[model samples]
Structure formats: structure tokens, C-alpha cells
Target: MALMTKLKHVDLLADGSLRYRRRIPLVAQEAVGKKVFQQRLQSKEGADLIKEYAEIESLYEQMVAQRLVRARKEALWGNTPRETFKAAKVSSESVWEGVRGLDRDDPEDRHLVAASLKDEGVKKLILNPNKTEPKPTLKDALKLYRKERVKDDAAMETRITRVWSEVEEAIGDLPLDELKRENARKVRDHMISVEKYGGGNRSAATVKRMLNVVKAVVSFGLVEFDLGDKTNPFIGLKVDDQGDREDTKRLPLPDDLTERLRASLRGDLAHIMTILDETGARVGEIVGLEGADLFLDHETPYIHIRPNTTRRLKTDSSNRMVPLTDAAQKSFKAALKEAETGGPIWPQYSRPRGSDSASAALMKNLRKLTKDRKFTIHSLRHRFKDRCRDVGMPKNIQDQLLGHSSVDVGERVYGSPEAKLRLAAQWIEKLT
Candidate 1:
């Protein structure tokens, strides 16, 4: 089966079929488990046999490359006996002979090869055919950040992802270890100078917040990767004297405006308004609801506020159960009739910016009802808090029901969920 004009390491089997054969290096034999790696060449043609030889040879080369890198790392760690694992014995020919002719037809393969080249540069000449990569950039750390910190409207996701976009623009995706204090300052100045809305520059407050997000992301990475010795460039920078003001916060909706708005709501808007009035859930949280999040068959009906694939809750504390009032019960019953089990109750807004879309629609309706900007859709949440306070609901109970920040209402003291449901239903009835 061997052609006389053919490649090295090609052999004829006893059955007269062609085969490719090679010896596995001693260091990698433990991982691969054989002295020689041989595979039958299915093709009997001359050109095809040579092609199969290269393909088989490349696989062997890849294994050798990985074993050599690991052996080098082990020697450096002083974990392996030096003479038994000599990386210096690795021949020049073994480093990515296959990679040189790697299929450029594959997009991911080409991209990874290029990206690896950018990191190592001219000083480190070899491509890692083993597919090992070194160190994460701020962009890389963003992936880790997303796993740990999910927030409203994907707030952590939005703000943090934006930080990486800015990082990529300014610094070319510098590794986390190389991110110096100067680099953070560069990003801050870049943010300040950019015109986010028309000709108007990004506000000092906006810049400060971006820096805070950057700090949070970097701090998260340092702790997670155990790179505490690395300097965090985003921390304690002097971008300010203009701090947040409490007066700018959304006010409770006036009673007359609430009554007028209640009268105006119709169709899907009516259902959303009724749920907001009864439960004080965020507009986004309501629109992003899946049918499973609602419990109607129980003795007391309630809406569970939590995160989903498309929507992110502001914090873990945002997840709580709100017992429905009579109006909410009617509205949700209608939604359940139309919605699929475990599917979105309001499919229109169950997406990446679904809440923002819902906000625009709500605000457009609110603008027609009132000229005042102070009484926005979010005032419903404030009004709910005020209503609870006026009805003399225990502060802890109010906090627990509304998902406001409170140290404890004592989960043990709250007892079973049925007890909590009965307790919440009693208080929510007063809001009606």
C-alpha cells in the first residue's frame, strides 16, 4: 500500500492496506498511553495518502506541544524531576508544523491564532497549537463579572460591558496585570470628553459612575483571580466634588394624578397599571414576567419578583413575593388566560431592553395625563412605600414586601411561605 514516491513514516500493513505511523515522545506517552501512534490511511491514491500523512502527523505534533508546555511548567514549579521532563529536548519541528498549514477556512481557528499572536508578539515566536491562552483582559474579566453581579435592566451588564467597550477603544485590551493607574485616568478623561447626548458632554456624575463601575469590575477580578498585588487604577480618583443629591429622587405620585391615570389606563396598559398599583413592582419587572412567576391557584394570589434570561433583578434582595390585591387578581387572571405556562406573560417587553421599551410606552401615556415630569412611572414604587408607611405596616414587613433594603424581618420569624402570604395579603388589602 506504500507508494515508493510517497511521504516519510508511511507503511504497508500485513493486510496490504496503507497506514501512517509515528513514535510518541516519552513525556507525552503517559498522557497518550502508547509508544507509537498509528492510523490506517483510508485513501489508496498518491496525493490523498500524502494528505493523510500530514493530518496524522499534525495530531501527533499537537500532543507533543501540550506535553512539552506542561512539562516546562512542572519543571518551573519544581514539581517534576528535571532530567525526566527536559523541555529542551523538544525539537524545533514539533512546534505547530500542522498549525502552519492550519485550515484558514475556519473563522474561529484563524481568530484564535491571530489573537494568540497579538499577545506573544515577535518575542514569543510559537503558536500554541494546544489552544492554551494566558491572562484575561478587562474584557475577559467582564465575562466573570456577569456571572456574579446581575442587576436591573441588566444594569451591571450594561454598565460593565460599556466599560469594556471604552477599555478596548482606549487601551487595546491590555491584560489585567498590566492595567496601570494611568490607564484608568485615560479612560476617565475619555468618558468626560465624549458627547453622549447631542453636543452636550457626559456629565461629571456620569463619569464618576463609570469609574465606580470600572472599580467594581476591577476589584471583582482582583479578588477572584487572586491578583490583589495588582494596582486598581479606577479607585479613589479625583473626578469630583459633585455628589448625588437626595432631592433629585422620584416623588410619590399625587392622589388626584393617580386617580386620573387609573381612569386613563386601558388594554394591556390597564393590566400593567393595576398590577403596579396593587403590588408596587417595577414596571420592567412586571413586563418581563413569565406565567410561572405568578401563583393564582393558591388560597392567596401573589407575584414573585425575580430575574430571568432577558431581565436582570437589581439585586438578590429584589427577589420577593408580593401578594396581589383584588384588582391585581383580576388583571393577572386575564394575563394567565393568554400566556403560555412557563412563558412570558407580556411577550412584547420580554427582551434585552424590554423594560426600557415598556418605560417609553408608559411615559408617553403619562405625559398625556400630566404636564409635570416629577410624577413619572417610577413614583408608583415610592407611593407604595408611602402607602405602606401610612397604613402602619411594620417597617420590617414593609421592607420585606417591597424588596427595599432592610437588615432583617427574620426569615425564621416569617415562618412558612403560606404564613407570609397570609400576612402580606392582609397589608396589601389596605392599599386598595
Candidate 2:
């Protein structure tokens, strides 16, 4: 009981170790999820006890600071006073937890404890549980934005997350209101000139997309956090043209390269590439294919492209039945046989937010096949379009086969799926 006699909130167990125990504040009960916070001091000696207590108390203070930041963010997002109080209470408990036990004999320890309390108070004031004027940091903005968007648009979420990661790397967590035009320019320059995005200077298309993602997130944060009146630094920001790299346009794979890819790729990757080459279906579409989506036995053997729980088509025009060529039919049969075990055609790649993962794996395999980075798995679709055009397929028919919105008003508004399918099947037969 020597430790207990010296320190308040410190209990001496039968084995002689000291323990600190305190009840969690009533307001923070929900957030902290505990009636009491307890930590064993793991020391019997007075000096060791004091040192360990200070360390633990410092950690507890840090925890409270974090909770307070969370509470303040909730308030900014329009959480009620009662809800914010829970977080405030947790923070208050953290400060008290740090200063609860005092060694009156040790003046240095007491001074250290007082200084820590002052530091915590300063942090709490800065966080300001009640006020919501100054917007949250770009870091917090990104965090909240991702939470809201990930459910609806995982691809966009991924892109935003990636862009923000680069931004964060270039400049540490900056306040949203403090994100000046200069900061925006720095980020753009960093991405295009300094950062090796995709192993080289970011192409013009990549720079534009990254800037767009940053701008969209900033815009979203302004609206979501009710800071719309604040100037958006990302708006009207320009990235110097890094020349016309044609980054987004996947080049058509030549016949020689196509043959090599077919021979080289194996397993699900091979099947995915084959489907892409023959059907011109997107990698996401093919990877997300289901047994039910395949209509092989029907009059027109085709793969139905539709949004499912796991994957979403890029646009409304993306939803259609692509008539299978003889080669595509063979690939689908092999994929179907594998899918007999149940779930999607490529179950391993069939994740709700997994298009990037699928693309990355395919790219790694592709690097082995060819040195040209432009000739990706997506190039199969471009190659398909080239082949369709070379064989004298009409523009409307080509658009239907590739799931592109037809430019012609009549074809776009009046074209039926069945009619398009017949035209597509005929053109596809020519290629086969």
C-alpha cells in the first residue's frame, strides 16, 4: 500500500504493482464505451511509479485531444450540442486523467503535470468545440469527403484518395481556408514536375485528372462543411501543359502484339484479356461478369453488360448485350466453366472497389509482355474498335458494339437493343 499512500487514484495490488483507475465522464460514456479507464502502473518503487504515471498520463491527454478534434468536426458537420458534449466530455476526462495523481514531495513532477494541463487546454481552445468558423484541415476534409463518397462512387473515391495522398505528401495537413493559390500551384507543380507519377512526369491528362480530383474534393468539402463562402484555392488553378502525351488513349494493339499477349497471358488474366479483345468490354465489365449475364445458348450468344452490386458500368450506354465472336465465345466458355463453382466469372477480381486492383495486376503481367506502357489491357478495346473500322463496320454499329453513345440523334434515341445486337453480331462474325 506504499504506492497507494503516495499517489491518489493509484491502487496497490496484493502482488505490489500500482494501478490507476478512474471513471469515464458521463458525457463521454458512449464515445469511450467504458464506465472506467484503468491502467496498471507496473511499478512498486516510488520514483518508477512517478515516471510511469507521467508517461501514461501524457498518452491519455493525447487521446483526449484527438477526441476533442473529432467532436469539433462533428459540430462543424451540424451535430447537435448533446452529441458534441459526448466528445467534449471525453476530452475533459483525458485532461483530468493526466493530472489526477500528484506527488507533492516531487515539485518537478508537479510542474511537469501543470505544464501538460496548460498544453491540453491550449489544444482544446484551438479545436473550439462550439465554434465552426475556420474550416477543417485539408486532411480532415479529405477524410470526411471519402467517407460520404466511397459508398456511391468507389472509383472516384479511389482517385480522390490517391490525389490527396500526393497532395499530403507535398504539403502536410493545411487548413482548408489556408489553401491559397500558391499552395494549389505548388501541388500541381509537384505532381507534374517533381513527383514521378506512374514512373515519369505526369502526362497532361494525368495532371488534369489529379487537379480535377483535388478541385472536386475542395468543392465538396466547402458545401458539405457549410464553408461554401470560403474561397476554393483549387478553383481556376492551372497546371502547365506537360505536352500532349495522349495518356488516356490506349493504343490499338497490333496483330503481332495481340498474338504474343494471347500466347503469354494465362489463367483469369488470359481469359480477361481474351474477352476484352473479342468483345471490347471494359476490364471491370468482364471481371464483374456473372453466370446469369452470359446468354451462350440463346440465338445470339452474348455477354450482358449491366451494373451489379459489385460493379457499376461507366455510363447508361455501357449497359447492353455485346454479341460474342467465336474467340470471345471460347473465352466465355472457359470462364463459365471456372465460374461453375459460383459467384462472378472472376471471383478473385470481383471486389466492389476493386477495379484498380484488377488493372494493376493486369498491368504488371503486361509489363512482362511488352515494354510499351501504352499497350495496356484496355488497349484491347481500342484494338477491337480499329479492327471493326478496318472491316468496314458502320459507325452506328461500331458504337453499339463498343457501348459508346451514338452521335446520331436517331441512333441514340431510337435504337433498340435487339436491333443493335443483330448488327453487332453480324459485324463480329466478319472479324471472327
Model 1: per-residue Cα lDDT over 169-277, one tens digit each = 6666567888888988888888876754212234567788778877887888887878889878788887853422342345888888887887755556668877887
Q: lDDT value for candidate 1?
A: 0.67
How well does candidate 1 score on lDDT at residue 32?
Answer: 64
* TM-score result, candidate 2: 0.67
lDDT of each: 0.67, 0.69
> What does candidate 1 score on TM?
0.57
RMSD for each of the candidates: 22.0, 18.0
TM, every model: 0.57, 0.67
User: CA shift at 9, candidate 2, in angstroms?
Assistant: 56
Q: Residue by residue across 103-182, what tens digits does model 2's lDDT show?
A: 53365554554465545543453244344433467766666766777555755554565566568667766777677888
Q: After superposing candidate 1 on the true structure, give the runs of residues whose Cα lies further than 4 Å from its correct spot.
A: 1-137, 140-159, 166-213, 216-230, 238-243, 260-266, 307-312, 367-373, 408-414
- Location of the lowest summed lDDT over 10 successive residues in candidate 2: 194-203
